[model samples]
Target: MLNLNGQTHRRLAEAMQQAMLIPEGDELVFVIGRGNESSNLEALETWVKESLDVLEDDLALAVLPLLLNRLGQTINHWSPV
Candidate 1:
């Protein structure tokens, strides 16, 4: 299982705020997937873009890759296996 502590959560929350995914001053409670299987990065990218398309924030959409990269880094850092 993933073991992200409070600091990691806060860091991701702050990053999401900066990316405008979550509004400033609003609280974000996100849950990472609990499965142990690896996923396809290309599919994940497509999914993220499609999911965020409704928001119509071009700048935020542009930053999605960076945000995803940050998330990958955080997960790699905290993954137990």
Candidate 2:
């Protein structure tokens, strides 16, 4: 199991970023500590949805495990820590 409380968040984010096949100009927002995990994840999801309004693939996420469930079955960029 992954802890959402401490350094795990940072590590998860970094791992995801390193594994992503991102293009230039895409942004990966770190919203982990800005709010509660659920809220922050929702906000990030909303941001992704809004961003998709213009360009669907303009963002990447470096997310912790709790939030990983929110991303569902499409993710292929994660690595175990």
lDDT (CA) for every model shown?
A: 0.47, 0.41
lDDT per residue as tens, model 2, 40-62: 33434444334444552232333
Pick the TM-score winner: 1
**Number of backbone-clashing residue pairs for each candidate, in the order shown:** 0, 0
Model 2 TM-score is 0.26
Residue clash pairs of candidate 2: none
The C-alpha stretches of model 1 lying farther than 4 A from their native spots are 1-56
Model 1 C-alpha lDDT per residue in residues 1-81, reported as the tens digit of each score? 234454554455455445755443212212222233133222233334434445456657787999999999999999998
Decoy 1 TM-score against native: 0.30
